[model samples]
Target: MKKTLLTLCSVLCCAVLFAQVPATEKQALLDLYVDTQGDQWINTWDLNEAVADWHGVTVENDHVVSISLLFNNLNGKLPASLGNLSKLRILELSFNKLNGEIPAQLGQLSNLEVLALNANGLSGTIPETLGALSKLKQLHMSSNKLTGTVPASLGNLTAVEVFNVFDNDLKGSLPAELASNNNLRELMIAENDFVNTEIFSVVLLSNSGSGLNLKSPSLSPQAKTIIAIESPEDGN
Candidate 1:
């Protein structure tokens, strides 16, 4: 009976140790904590505690999966180590004070689905590597100071549903490849310096309820035609 009890205790201890995420993933989380000034976060993590006890971090089967830290007072640039969470699905860090260019390493997160970085102070052009997120659904980077053309490579997001880059300083013509995604439902690219808006006319015409919000100073006649078609009530 004594030997059996000792065996059971050892098994329990092993299970407890295994319950924690891998060292690489845990280090990634720690990098995020340190990079984003976790000490200043409204809900800070206690390094002494298990990773499962960390706020906004979700672990499953000892793998870090999702992190939802929206409006959490994260005041620094995102760490490149975030890509180390290979199983990560949703990364919601919007409404924070994070700035600096988005790490192109984020494109390494092949399992990423929802990436919400809106309502922040992030600058620099959207990383072209983001087009590698084949499984991404809702991408929100609006209300930032982003510049340059929308990466034509973003058209590779065949599974994307909502793409919102509204109220930024992005310029250049909208890529026709972007309109080819059949899964796209909500496209908000307003208040920018985009030219050659006619590329989206067919998209606007075919997907009437796709919720496209384009407002540029130089709208082509075809763009105006689609705009008129989208808002018939405005004609009155």
Candidate 2:
């Protein structure tokens, strides 16, 4: 009986110890991400290793689990190998001076939940490959130089809740498939040159309250509904 009890205790300890994040791995990755920015400083923002002190990046076993690096002076291109941290759940890199188009390789993080890259200087189109992230819940890529129409593939994120891309230079109409995003709550697409819109989902403030002429027959239902709410005078 004594021997059996000791074995059971050992097993339990191992299980708990192997759980999300080994301290060394977490610190290593955190150090790498912060140090990636080196000593770059823009405006009032500056990237410092000390900033990682307030971050909550941790690793499970050998995998990074969560990393929230908001408002850091992280200037430079994102590493192409970032998807290697497969266990990430929340990745918030908003309010940074990061440049370059978002790598399509980032779409490989299937476990990701919240991805916020809004209000930055990121340029390029949203990758259609991001539709593969089945577990993603919140995605905000608003306020950037992101050209091209919104990717219809984003409709695959059925779990998505809050989606916004207001105040950008994105052209083309919203896709009808986006209406399938029933879990959507706050869909902000105001202040853009987007045309040929349709609305069949979501709630929004009437930026113009209907006066749109969606020239595209393929306008998504959600886009049409958004246009319907906008008055003609507000469509400028």
Candidate 3:
């Protein structure tokens, strides 16, 4: 009888010792695999095992913090469950064949710092909900089929250092508020149909310390006039 009690207690202890990751997070990864068609992926997951054992997934303190699957040939839409990774800090899924709109639920990742989704087949407008990511520092969504104007609410990302959305079909004037964020270093929006581009001048002036790489479509004559007015006067 004593042997049976000892064995049962040991089993309970072992279960506690090897507690799996949170169901929400585990399900999030599974959703990603299924939605993104991980079966066709270059590096695929064995869903029967722990998520921590999955490739390109980084976990800390039993929580997922990063998912680096760049150039992995993932083809499909990004699942909404991905936003459940509240502890996620870096999400690098660039250079994939994923399509569909950027999930607004991603704004729930308040701790996110780097969001790299460039070089995909994604289409649709940038979600304004992304402004909720106050900790975000780098946002790369270039070389996609994204359209619509740059979200003015993105100016709320005062911590942002690099913002690139070039080589898209986007149009309309850039948000004037984007200039106030002095932390910005690289602002690439070229190959789009942006107008009233005086915002770039303000960004340059405020971001003097950072190595700013500003790009935009060919400015309209009026925009050129604004740039000329904003330019420093030549010293006599």
Best-performing candidate as measured by TM-score: 1
Worst 10 residues of 3 by lDDT: 227-236
In model 2, which range of ten residues has the least summed lDDT?
A: 227-236
lDDT digits (tens) for residues 109-214 of candidate 2: 8899888776778888888888888898877776678888788888788888766676577877676666666787656676666664455455454233343332
TM match of model 2 to true structure: 0.68
List of clashing residue pairs for candidate 1: none
Predict model 1's lDDT versus the native. 0.80
Q: What value of lDDT does candidate 3 attain over all alpha carbons?
A: 0.78
lDDT of each residue in 1-236, candidate 1, tens digit only: 99999999999998977588999999999999999899999999999989988999998888988998987999989999998889999998888999999999999999999888878899999998999999999787878889999998788888987777777899987667766677776566776777755565432321234544555554555554332122211210
Models 1 onward score TM values of 0.83, 0.68, 0.79
lDDT of 3 by residue, 1-236 (tens): 99999999999888765667799999899999989999999999988777777899988878999999988999999998889999999999888998999998998999999898988999999999899999999888878999998888887998987777766888887777666677865566556677756555432221122332234544434332221111111110
- Model 3, position 227, has a per-residue lDDT of 13
Clashes of each: 0, 24, 0
lDDT of each: 0.80, 0.64, 0.78
> Could you report the Cα RMSD, in angstroms, for every candidate shown?
6.2, 7.5, 8.3
Question: On a 0 to 1 TM-score scale, where does candidate 1 land against the true structure?
Answer: 0.83
| Deviation (Å) of 82 in candidate 1 | 0.7
